[model samples]
Target: MNDSLIFATEGFGLNLNLFETNILNLAVVVFGLYKFLPNFLGSMLERRRSAILQDLKDAEDRLEDAAISLNQAKKDLASAEQKAGKIRNDCKERAEAIRLESEKRTVEEMARIKQGAASDLNLEAARVSGQLRREAARLAIEKALSSLSNSLDDKAQDKFLRQSIKNIGDI
Candidate 1:
């Protein structure tokens, strides 16, 4: 009985020592984790937060640039539309001028053709009138000759002939 009691007391002491060792090891691990984990996690979180802020700033800058470019593009489009309108107006004016010029040229050409035709008609009329006058003169001469042949007789002719000979000797 006495030996069994000694053995039981030794076992109880060993259990107590093991419990103390385990408690000390748990405390050391807890202390080490408490000291190191905060710094590591804080640094990593700070880096991630900085990267997020930078990305946000970059997005803002890009948005501003896009807005500026959009405004410029709108201005350019408006200017181009004005230029196109001016060009269209110029072309219309030029076309109108050309049309007017063509009309004037056509009128002038018609006038010239009319004048030339009038001149040719006048010349033809003059030629026809001259031919008619010549025909009338030839008929009158033939009528006069026939009338003279009928009027004069043989006796009258001899008397008139003696009178012309006296007149010619006086001249």
Candidate 2:
């Protein structure tokens, strides 16, 4: 039928005793926790927030430093590359100069060798001509000596000597 059995034991009993229900103690404990816990927890949370903000700022500063370092490194690399290029160009120019100097020296040496050869040839030719002239003079003198012995007797030699003396006196 109805729910009469549940309410048949007693009427609605409202217990207002503070010791039994512990409502006053609960209120005091909640009040103390509310007052003390906020001070401790709020200070801790503030410290954590400050630490996070400091970390963020430090990270940003580090990033800026890295950026500056990267820029400086780039400039240094460019400078090094330019120096290397200049050195390469200088080396090439020096090599070219050396080659030219070597060529000039080779040409000069060749010319000197040719001049020495020509001088030697001229000296040889002069020696041959002198020998030929001496040989011809000696042959002519021998032929004259043989003919003089055969054709010119004592009378002809005396006549030539007397005529040569007369011509010298007239001169």
Candidate 3:
């Protein structure tokens, strides 16, 4: 039975029964491939083309967005730099103004102090002069009285006393 099953009725290539059936199967396969392969492969290729185009479009859009973002960042950086420069200039101007104001105030304060000192000095000089004048007058009066008492005799004293009495009566 195994031998019967394994044995071919006719030789390998020249058999009439199996050759016709194989030829029919080959024709059917060729016909099916010729009929279906173009449509299948065309649809598959179209789908792949669409996917690739979509990916390219997406990449282009992303690139455009990145360019726009980069431009915006550059603009922001420029604006920030301008603001920083303005701030630095403003700070420098403010510092200069403050320094000038401080110098002006310092000069004014020094003038005021000098004026006060000058006024004080004048007041002290006047006070000292007045005190010296009073001292000089007192000393002159005492010296005159001492000289007169020492130089006058008893007769001159009596005559001077009579002259003083006459002057007092006239007053």
Candidate 4:
């Protein structure tokens, strides 16, 4: 009436049983691990791989966006630099033009001043020359009259007076 349902090998377990050694339990556990472990581990690995691939894809997209933004920023910076350079050149040209114009005006004003001074000098010289000529003529006329008074005899003076009077009457 004490029958324990344990199967035993005939030669190896002549006195031992499956319930004592737990060989049946060990076999079932080993068989279960062999049959199901690969599926469980493979599914877990596949999920992890998919998540890693998705993460890599997202990272790549973000990197591409960043690259585009960096390129646009570079272009904007270059455009701003070009505009700044153009403005600088325009300002330099304007400054040069203003300087040249100022120099030209100054030269023109100086030339006008020199010409005015020359004209005034010429007028003064002409006035002085005319005055000298009048003075010289007066002196010569006085010397001639003095000499004529000394050399003129009465007969000659009378003849000279008659001829001069006739010339005046004809004119």
- Cα TM-score per model: 0.62, 0.72, 0.63, 0.47
Better of 1 and 4 by TM-score: 1
Tell me the lDDT of model 2 at 98. 100
lDDT of 1 by residue, 1-171 (tens): 333233465446233454545978888889988999889999999999999999999999999999999999999999999999999999999999999999999999999999999999999999999999999998997896567557878787678668879999999
Poorly placed runs, candidate 3 (over 4 Å) = 1-41, 145-171
Q: For model 1, name the residue pairs that clash.
A: none
| Model 2's TM-score against the true structure | 0.72
TM-score of predicted structure 3: 0.63
Give lDDT tens digits, candidate 3, residues 1-171.
223233455553334454545978888899999999989999999999999999999999999999999999999999999999999999999999999999999999999999999999999999999999999998997897678789998898789889989999999
Each model's lDDT: 0.85, 0.90, 0.88, 0.89
- Clash count list over all predictions: 0, 0, 0, 0
Off by over 4 Å in 1: 1-32, 138-171
Native-to-model Cα distance after best TM-score fit, residue 46 in candidate 2, in Å: 1.9
Model 1 worst lDDT window (10 residues)? 1-10
| RMSD in Å for model 3 | 6.6
Question: What is every candidate's alpha-carbon RMSD to the true fold?
Answer: 8.9, 6.0, 6.6, 8.1
lDDT of predicted model 2: 0.90
Query: Tens-digit lDDT track for model 4 on 1-171?
Result: 223433445533243457776988999999999999889988999999999999999999999999999999999999999999999999999999999999999999999999999999999999999999999999998898778778998888789879989999999
